[model samples]
Target chain A: MFKRIWGWIQRFSSPKHFYDISGKMIPWFAVSALLLGVYGLYMGLFVAPTDYQQGESYRIIFIHVPAAWMSLFIYMVMAIASAIGLIWQIKLADMVAAASAPIGAWFTFLALVTGSLWGKPMWGAYWVWDARLTSELILLFLYFGYMALQSSIEDQRTADKASGLLAIVGVVNIPIIHYSVEWWNTLHQGATVAKFDKPSMHIDMLIPLLVMAFAAKLFYAAVVLVRARNEVLMRERNRQWVRELVEKI
Target chain B: MLKAFYHLLARDLRLAFRLRHELANPLIFFVLVVSLFPLAVTPNAELLQEMAPGVIWVSALLSVLLSLDRLFKQDYEDGSLDQLMLSPNPLVILVLAKVAAHWLLTGLPLVLIAPLLGLFMYVPAEANGVLMLSLLLGTPVLSLVGAIGVSLTVAVNRGGVLLSLIILPLYIPILIFGANAVDVASDGLSVRGQILFLGAVLAMSISLAPLATAVALRITASR
Candidate 1:
């Protein structure tokens, strides 16, 4: 079974194969993402009871939490895929890393904007140089740097290696950014849900947050597939499979 | 093996010195940048002293970045990089020698001149010793880490700006610690902790960055 799964993974490492597979999955992902997102938002906004402390304004957690999670999660995916590409010389891993950058960058921006929106009503200021917030901002810069570095080089192979090295190096900053709030005395609040003992959030609020997190994952999967398909089409344009596929289209 | 190492180092130094005009630009840029803050903001002695460490550190980081591309560019262009690749000694060691040469010319000058600039910025005379020491331990790491960026981008034309974009994020932790070391020193607090942390980072980067840079250069060179 393990060998079988490894074979499948190895086979799918081909851009043509991966593109064909992910293309079929995108519509299902799109529909599920929309449905789950709507349901999550409704549950978060109306069904969830208002926080005694933060009141209705706390509903922003539905968007804010998912966006924050995707920001960190997408980077981890990018880094891991880059590592696989670097280690195993997997072309599809590189393509995946390439596809994920813009999506990850968008989610990071959303996290920052929505976090600020949530902060305004709760923290009484639009911005603070809090550890979590500052690090998240740096995360955005890292994404932009990754994308910029990739695009600046005209040679696709050189661009892959250069941006891959960068992605690997910048991985160090991710943990530091995540933990800066804990390590330093910053205005950012400490862990509410990520804590070890038990989550501090009430079950009602936590459920919608969890649903939105799933929705964000589905959204990312859907988008990554679509983007990866486009990237595959561009990169494999000279190949027989792409030529055939384009002819069919 | 040692002879080959020193020969490459000496060759690079000669080439760099031959284009002394290009080499001096980053230092001049550093000075110009350092001068700008005092002009843009008040030249109040107290305020200048307060902002001096961050300004000097940031400018030094930029200057280091400015000079970093030359660490590999000429060799890469003239096929001397190929010769180095074909050499018996491990490329990582060769890379370390090149980075050391870069630090000697670029980072070392900044460390030496920092005290003088600190004076102009109204840094107290007593903090000068700590400033020099922190920079001494810190700046080599900057060159070492910055070399990785240069190597990765060496194949791309007009990569200098992209190189900065790629490297600056990695440089932040060092900047934070390096500046904090001076800040603590200026405040007359315990500089020991911050200096130790900066040294730890330097040691870690010194060991790892060259190997990473060598791998990156090999990929670029091979392609």
Candidate 2:
């Protein structure tokens, strides 16, 4: 069984094989993302009751919370891909790590912007150094750093290795950053905005949130796979199969 | 291995002294940046004191960041970095020695000079000690972590800004702990917890950062 599994792994490790497989999987992920997104947004916008306190303004949480979750989640994915790439020198893994950067950065940017919009009505300021907000800002910077480090190096292999080490290092620091921000906020006794979820969170609110979270994850899958396929084509462009496929197109 | 590490450390220190201008730039930047806050922000002593912790920490961070390009660039340029890579001694030890030298030159002086800056900012005399101590514990982590960034970007021409981009986010935890220690001290709170946190960061960075730096160095230097 182990040998058979290892054989499957070896087969999928080839760029051509992985490319063929992912091309087939992308539409499934894309369609699911679209279907789930439409339902989640419709339900979140209309079915969920407005917050008793913040009223209609609270609806932004549907986007803000999921984007925040994706920002962190994408970083973890990048970090793991980086680790696997570094350890095994898997080109696909490196491409995945590279592809995740801009997507992760966009998610971080969306989260920050949506968060500020949410903050304006609640905190009376567009920006506040709340612990969560502060940590998310730092997370955005981490994404920029990863992207910058990758782009600065001219050699792809060296860039992958260097940025992979950084991703691993940055991942280790994330928990530390989160905890310290929490500690600093509490010590300063800054005006703490309560989290989006209250003690009595409704099932109607919960359903859309859970659905949106899945939609976001699915979107990530579709996008990252498409990106990874493009990267694979670029990196394998010199190969016979790639040339033949290109000629056919 | 210990002897080799000592030699590397001593060599870096001697080189730093020989080129005094590079050694002095960060200190001048530190003082200038801290001084700029009062001029740019309010001159009110109370407000300055309130902003002092963050201001000091941020300036210190920028100064360290400004100097990080020097950490590996000079050696990389002179081809000594290749020699270090080829050395029989473990690269981690050598990297750690370089970082220790960095802390000695940049971080130690910053720690010593922080109290006067605190006084200038109207930080109470009681909190000055904590500010200094916090820098003392915190800046080594900066040197160690910054070393990893320098090692990664060392080969890229004019990687100064890119190095900062790669490093500043990683510096957030240290900044939070260091600034909060001073803030807590100014408020007459027991800063034992914050100081301990800074110490913990230093410990963690010391053990881990050099290994990462060494790996990055091998990757960058080989290419």
Candidate 3:
């Protein structure tokens, strides 16, 4: 069973095969993302009732929370892809990891911006040195570091392997960094983050938030697939299949 | 295997001592930068005392980072790193020996000099001992983790800024706990928790970082 599964993986991960299939799969992902995002946004922005405390302003969580989720989620995907590439020498996995970096960085950036936007009216400040907020900033730095390492290396294969190792190292330290920041925050400031608590989010509020998170996932799939397709074309530019495809196009 | 470890450790130590000036540069950078905060920020002793922990830790971290470019570059350039790798002994042990030598050259001095600079920062004299102890436990982790970064980038030309980007975020945990230990000590609170946390991080990095560094060196060598 393991051998067969491995065989299937080897087949699917071939750059040419992935290019052929992912081109066809993008539309499905795009349409699903579109439908879900539209529904989720409408329900979240319009249908969900206003909070008794913050009134209409709290609705920003619909975007902020989902972006925050994707930032962390996409990092995990990048690291896992990098690990697969390192251990198995899967060229496609390396491409996927490389393609995922910029998108993941944007999500992290989005999460930070949207979070601070929400903080403005709620906390009367554009930003706070909250533990989670600080971690997100450090995570952004890690993503930049990974991307920088990838770009600085002139050799593509070496870049992939080196940055892959970095992603794994960063992932391992994320928890430790987060915990220490939390400990440091609390040590100096006594429970200043209490206002972040929401009063047991309403079911109506909860449903759209869940839907938005799922929609964000689908959006990521659609985008990452497109980016991975580009990576495949570039890395395989010298191959016969790529020339043939270019001629056909 | 033990012989290889000791020999490499001794060799690196000897080479480092031979270049007495470069050996002292990062240590001097540490002391100079730590003293700059009072001049740059404020001369108030009360405020300086409060900010001392963070300033000292950040300076130490940066100086360690500045010194890290020397860790693998010479061996790599001379092709001795490949020779070291070709040895029958496990590469991880060799990597650990190099990192230990680096700590001896660069990290141990930071621990020793921190108290003298701690005096400049008006750190509580009692907390000065805690500062040294925290740095003693913490700086080895810095060297170990920094080795992984240096090994990864040893192939890239002018990888200094990129090295900082890769390694500094990873250093945040150690900085927090190491600095916090002294801060807590100064506050007359029990610093046992912070010290223990630093030790835990040190133990983990010692076990894991050498393996990562070995892998990174292999990757660099292959390229």
Top candidate, metric TM-score: 3
Q: CA shift at A6, candidate 2, in angstroms?
A: 3.8
Clashing pairs in 3: none
Residues A8-46 of candidate 2 have per-residue lDDT tens digits of 877898899989999999999999999999999999999
Clashing pairs in 2: none
Q: Distance from true position, residue A133, model 2, in Å?
A: 1.5
lDDT of 2 at A179: 90
DockQ of 3: 0.91
Cα lDDT tens digits, model 2, B28-144, are 999999999999998999999999999999999998888887788889999999999899999999999999998999999999899889988999999999999999999999999
Model number with the top DockQ: 3
Clashes of each: 0, 0, 0
Q: What lDDT tens digits, residue by residue, belong to model 1 across residues A214-249?
A: 999999999998988888889888999889888998
Model 2: residue B67 alpha-carbon error in angstroms = 1.2
How good is the docking of model 1, as DockQ? 0.51
Q: Write the per-residue lDDT of candidate 3 for residues A88-202, one digit (tens) a residue.
A: 9999999999999999999999999998998888777899887778999999999999999999998999999999999999999988998899888887764665455657889
**Index of the highest-lDDT prediction:** 3
Span of 10 residues, lowest total lDDT, candidate 3 chain B:
B31-40
Cα RMSD to native, each candidate?
3.2, 1.6, 1.0
For residues B36-116, write the lDDT of model 3, one tens digit per residue: 888899999999999999899999999999999889999999999999999999999999999989999999999988889
Candidate 3 segments whose C-alpha is farther than 4 A from its true place: none
**Regions of model 2 farther than 4 Å from truth:** A1-4, A192-197
